[model samples]
Target: MVIKVERVLHMVGGGGETSYATNSRLQEKAIYRTKPILEIAVAEMYRTLLPEKMVVVDLGCSSGPNTFLVVSEVLGIVGDLCRRLEQKPPEIQFFLNDLPGNDFNNVFRSLERYEKKMEEENGGLLVPHYVVGVPGSFYGRLFPCNTVHFFHSSYCLTWLSQVPQGLGSEQGVPLNKGNFCIAENSPPQVVKAYQEQHRRDFSTFLKSRYVELSIGGGMVSTFLGIKSKHPANDELNYLYGLVAEALNAMVSQGIISENKVGTFNLPIYGASMQEVKSVIGVEGSFDVEKAESIWDPFDDSDNVLSGKNVASTLQAVMEPLISHHFGDAILHELFSLLADIITARHLLKDKCNYTVLNSNSLSSCHRRHGH
Candidate 1:
């Protein structure tokens, strides 16, 4: 069955133990690491545009403290800049966009508290900002043409708009059995399908954003990427491989059928820097100012505890898609098995670190006609 990703794909909601809100420390860390880059991007945009009303968007802004963290960071930068210049701060129109299935209600409910916190912190100098929630896929346009001034996304673009097609045969046979991602054992066709999907989706993303951004506007996006051009050689493959192993264990216990495991593939890709740069070149909409790759490998000094942390993080991100495919009954058992496999077979054995790619200060090629 083809997955309707926008209908079901989302990080686990709320503040529960298995929720994305509770398990997103890894993503939070990435945000802080990318903060300096974000600072430069925002400052440059404001100095260049100096619009009385600035439009800023955070794509794939999932629910949690991390969501609010972005808001605070942007406000702080823009507000401080205006204060130092003794200029009137632009009214910020901030949009937090994600798939329709994201926990926007949770994000909405927390807004009042966030506002109170901001007031307590920034006081009289707070930038007049309006926060709006936009629900939709980023693969398509979300705003009017030439309206938005800046965009920021973190740990989101790795997800494809949908799972790649041709993973199964016309006769209903699953091709990439026993794995849900581009693994060492994944068929060549399976790998090719993922690559094509990433190229198509990412190109469409750039094209759409190019149309939406005003002249001189840009976006900063940070996401998972493979250090090696070969997809199978990366730690990202092994990380998902552990999850596949846990699913196979369930098949052994007759909890889920082999066909069920075989048919499921994650709608995510870890593109190499070359692959990303290639897409940007082909799209020809934005100019990349700076791109850097950071190593955020898991710490192995406490492999036992770190193993559990990895399991929890993956569970939060993967639970929605897995539960939709295999039923919610097996979630606890599945992640528990994953934790054990991670501790025994992987983290305890080899010190591996996942790679995070930060691409920032991507200003649109569009500029004022005479400039």
Candidate 2:
């Protein structure tokens, strides 16, 4: 009885203006964190490759809002760097990428809006070469070999389309035969499996980047990560399992069905800094110009004190998990009740206090020569 979870579609643009507000806030945070890193990355790419014209690609570009922010920032930095180096600024061809199911219509609209702004401000001569939409995973190759000068992906790599099979409610077991699970109190085997999967996924990701980027090119990535040496008992994974347990309890109470509960899974993994570096370094392509762990204050806060906020935040974070485990048939009333119960009795209230870490505090090591 292998119950496979369904892919959860994140509600991006559905209702009126309000529906897009949450996504907009999230996008803003993503842009803010990624902007400086991208500036450094593009400047490094130009310095190292010294190409006459550089082509930049934004992998997992999602909507044009965030993509444009990164692209514009990178161009500004590259322009400044070119002036310092006494060279012509590289012509940038922006590639906005995302999964095929993403809201590209909105993305294209956003691009048009930014394009107009650029033309109006720069007298149309400073306009970037814009190719509106390119769809695919960043973990796979989507462009010509060695065509991209700089690549950037932020808050995107943690997601895979689906949780690996033989885990969660569908599998009915904590430990798969060969896979690792990172749930709270997860067995040693389970944790090992999860780490192994991350290693594999990251290796593939690096190999793909190696193919996509030319020699001496670099990438700047920022993702949700954990701080754990041992594979078992990771706090973040435990948090997810706790949320999953609450959802399952709702299913048992007839508030949702087993089939519905098994419809979605959390589409993310919080890898530790060491784990990310290990995988990327082993690939031997990227120089790892910068690698650092920074906390997202917005995400770390304990805003779930109020019932309404709890329910809303729970719905935002756990909706994918719920939709992955349970079908979309769960009633709103049941979801609210489950959220209330979890907040009242089970949520980690004390550990909710979060502080933002300095970006310079990141542990950065360059790639060794020849890999």
Candidate 3:
């Protein structure tokens, strides 16, 4: 019943209403907001190691306009620093990574345009930047040991490799039933199960990256998080909770089987700032330089259209996963349910449902590596 995330998770690519390339303005804004931190990371890197040749990798880099934005920020900073240092810009080996199912064709098609922009903006300092697509998962090694210099991953760490191992019973019944993710009403056991899965998966991720980063090499990561450690403080439940409610409504009218709702859960976790730092600390491979909660999703806007936006955005990001689990027949109904749920849920914008996390793990190896 478990779908390999590498085969199931990806944004809808291309120019369409549900396409991430078209509707990821919110994610693009989030990336823009993190530019300052990215600049700081790159600047600090130049202070110590200004190599004539450099290597940078972007993990979980889905295909879209947002995919290039982070690395572009890093590239700009590197270019500026080189000019100030009176040093020739480095020949960057940039890798854009994501699941194998990602629409890499779309990204590759956009590169000429991106390069043209970079050349004009940087005075041709980026003349020889070499970019390639790397398909894989960050939960495991994707590059050679000690090879990468700067690694950037944004808005993707919250996805678990699989559902928590112990959320089911001896009879094969779900222990954390009726919800797609952890929620306020979830039992303590359910909470612990999710926490443990995040810990293990994140630990694996750090270990792999630790082996890949050269000394003084660093990473800047942004992912979904929570305002507090307590499960009750979860702010992301409104969307999933509403999804569950909609299904329940259907079940009440015998529209869908109750067994379907009981058996499904999203392999995602919205960790608290504490959870993020704690894993970095426990993983023992990287040092956490700066870790903090950046912005509140609710505070980002009270747009009456947020529900629609949320549905469109998530559908673009998660349709593959949903369809893999429940089949495409339910997509229309499911998203309609989600849109209505967001429209009705009125927990003020600041209640902390969705949060952007900031973490700079300043930690490589070289033999081909990735993820």
Candidate 4:
């Protein structure tokens, strides 16, 4: 099995135009869209029990402004809710997790200012939560048993730990063919290979969390996904189609070789609601409480930023992966085309065909039943 794990696919680790920090407004919007769920989780936890000490884990917490956004929200919620109930807020131990290649420096640097901001906003009434960075893959155990109480992640699960295996020929050659992700024209075998990898990774994710979450603890996660099960329903198919077409046009102009497209496969799969439900149902550790596709990840409601928001957002995280595969030479050309495509689509219609998912932001929380 051949699998490629390019470092860039992890995330853009800075505040540049193509960096995760600059382009994560979509994720923020997604987070806000899921506010009702967060409120329920916070309310439930504090209502039933408020431990003197508690733990919260943020997985796939990349180096960006959004890095601590959810953590801050969780802290704020815990503090406010406890105060309302006349209970002391739990002493929080916050853990930020990501692959080893992620930029922890940028994250650490922002901590002091973020803390100051939190302190100022809460009128010095905020609980001081301890934060630690844990670097590793969440597809496996990331902490000691019974350590975390509440877990959160967003905009990261679509990434497989490695490229899907078995997309090669008997001769050990790549069969995905000139595409970096699922396409409308992609072969069934290619699609199957990607789907299998998502199911395996998602199941591993659930089992690992089951081990780490405390009794009655839960998780909140989000992914960029859709509700349709058909492989063609993938939004990446459309977005990357814009990219693949541009690359092909360049191929005809002889800017690059035709063979480049044959080996590149986007190591991403936004799980459909059906796909996620199947795994959660099978894993049996976490119950899928709400698998609703709330809002479009690309809801440019009033054409404000128009489509630049979409392009910049995708560019920040994708530049590394796309440039890694195609070299940085053609990126400017590639995304410019993508921006135009997004703008035209946004202006012409109020609703998008593909639902932008950032689910549980994977916000699925499983109560520890039968534990």
Candidate 5:
């Protein structure tokens, strides 16, 4: 299918304003919380592969603000370790990657700021050799074989393109028409189809990573996921149902037309830990280094439910999906209503929490993959 690059870029730009602050804060949290996990991954890479220079890539790098935050933290840790060991620091090359539609302007601006900060603080001693933007899906090889040492991606893979087939109005059915709900609320076929799509997307993701990472290289990624034994109540399908319920309510109330509601689909999928490991194993290139599952309650501090935070979270989660399903015109109104509903229903006010899986906890797998 032909990708609507311009349309996607416009969508990103529209949402870019609010995301600046929210993404910054979220990146800080990710950097701090995930530091130990990253350090372990990097240490494994150094011990096993022993690359003279560490080439790190951030897939789905977006506007590069988060990329800068993560890379800076990783480099700082690496620098400290080198000092303690009395070994010279490894040369670092950071490649910031994303789709062609990502907002390059914002990314470049952020990079300039990062460069200025480095010049002032480090006197350019710790400069990355290359800070380049690569445009394409990370589900394919973006670099030559054996070129990368480490990879990091956060909160990006769960999104496929705007027109994920089998969803929306073209099918003449509600998005959740057949989803299993409350044990027996929906049809089994629907659940199978939903799951099958994620399996395919995830499989594609693994294959892509396999081609890009060197034999001994590793990747650390985190995504919204669930810890459930039953396949039906997995976080991905459950959240899909929740968003579908909200959309269906809006359709029934005439807040949005049935056709418009029909056009939209949730752009995210929350995989279970087992599901992630299985997919990675099937893809066959990397061993699980560390796997951790934790439920981070989304309190008011997360800003997902409060004044400015509410708008930012809505934009981050809804913009891509809305632009893909509905046109840009409706996004503002739709998200506004969504935020209102979330607030009025006191959903965010109560504690919006979800589970996340980290890769640092898989030490043995790291050793195995490093070999």
Candidate 6:
């Protein structure tokens, strides 16, 4: 059975050992690394439109310190721009969007502290901004037409709307056995199925967002990607391939069914920059302004790789879906096995999983055609 990602997927909740909030240093580093790009996008959009109220949305904003990091980045850029221009700052409407299962309650509880911090940082003159939570899948419409002025999403678009179909036979037999995501052994048909699913999902996402974004508006997005179009044996595939190995280990001990391992696949695709540009071109709503692959923030050559740290981070992101499919019993042992495998293999020593950064400006033709 194909899992409904919106319903099943979420970061590990609460401030616990495996919670995303605690283990998200990698993503936090990514946000900071991409800050300059975000600054440009926000400043350029504000300068061109000069709207009285600037509306910004952070899609797939899982609850964490990074949740408000994007908001603060936008506020600081726009607020400073207004000062330089000697114009009053525009009212900022910020939306933090994620799937319904995200730890929004934790995010909500942290707001008071964030606001107090903001007030103190602003010297008691808080920037004119309103924050709200928007829970929904970004693969479909989430806002009214022509409302949003800017959008920022980081480490999110890699998630597919649903698991790719055709991994199984007409009689309900598994095809891509002994693996979860794309791997060196994945059959050509399995790979094509995943590629087609990503194309469909990305196209739908762009069409929906284009309808919601106002004329001349823009977006900055950063997502995990592969340096090469061939996904097999790529950095991302190897990263997830380790997890598949752990599962197969369990299957050997009869801790989990082999069929279960055969049927499950991660709903994520590490698209190359070429694939991203191709989708944007075919979607026809936005013009790609800039696109490039950035260095992997997780790679730190100065220190030896810590298997526990890597396992915790992946657990924070994958635990919910893993538990839903494989039962809670497998979580602790599963991650423990994964940790041992990482240390034994020393897989991350020189590997780099590239991140794709894109800044897209809504096309004028979209406005002219009233699309």
- Models 1 onward score TM values of 0.96, 0.77, 0.91, 0.89, 0.82, 0.94
lDDT of 5: 0.61
User: Candidate 2: where are CA atoms >4 Å away?
Assistant: 1-11, 14-21, 24-27, 82-87, 117-127, 168-181, 230-235, 258-267, 299-325, 334-348, 351-371
Model 1, backbone clash pairs (residues 3+ apart or across chains), number? 1
Candidate 3 stretches with Cα past 4 Å from truth are 123-127, 170-173, 298-302, 347-353, 364-371
Candidate 2, residues 91-192: lDDT per residue as tens digits? 677788777756677767666777777667656634246565787666667888877766777666666544554454325633432112355455554455
lDDT of 6: 0.83
The candidate scoring highest on lDDT is: 1
Residue 47: error of model 5 in Å?
3.4
Q: What C-alpha lDDT values do all the predictions have?
A: 0.88, 0.57, 0.77, 0.74, 0.61, 0.83
lDDT of 1 by residue, 1-371 (tens): 67899999999999999999998988898899899999998998888778899999999999988998999999999998998888898999999999999999999999989989999887753799999999999999999998998999998999999999888754666678788989998889999999999999999999899889888787899978899878988998889988999999989999889988888888999998889888998888777788999987655348898778899999989999999998999999999999899989888877668888888755445533421
lDDT string, candidate 4, 1-371, tens digits: 12356345567776777788877777777777776777777567556557888898888888877888887888888887877888877788999999887889999999999888888987884776898999888989999997787888776788897888766653655465556678776678888988999999999988898888777676677777866667666564676676677677778888777767666667788787778777888887777655577546464554635566677777877777767777899888777766777777643554344455433422234342432
Better of 4 and 6 by lDDT: 6
- The runs of at least 3 residues in candidate 5 whose Cα sits more than 4 Å from the true structure, single-residue gaps closed, are 1-11, 14-17, 20-24, 119-124, 161-172, 175-186, 229-246, 249-255, 302-308, 360-370
Candidate 4: residue 176 lDDT (0-100): 59
Q: lDDT tens string, model 5, 287-343?
A: 675788767644346433453454455466456645566557666665566556655
- Which candidate has the highest TM-score of all? 1
lDDT over C-alpha atoms for residue 74 of model 3: 76
Worst 10 residues of 5 by lDDT: 178-187
TM-score between model 2 and native: 0.77
Using alpha carbons, what is the TM-score of model 6?
Answer: 0.94
Ranking according to TM-score, highest score first: 1, 6, 3, 4, 5, 2
User: Number of clashing pairs, model 6?
Assistant: 0
* Per-residue alpha-carbon lDDT of candidate 6 for residues 163-236, written as tens digits (9 for 90 to 100): 89878854666677788878998889989988999999989988988889987688888887887669885777
Q: Model 6 misses residue 283 by how many Å?
A: 1.1
Worst 10 residues of 3 by lDDT: 362-371
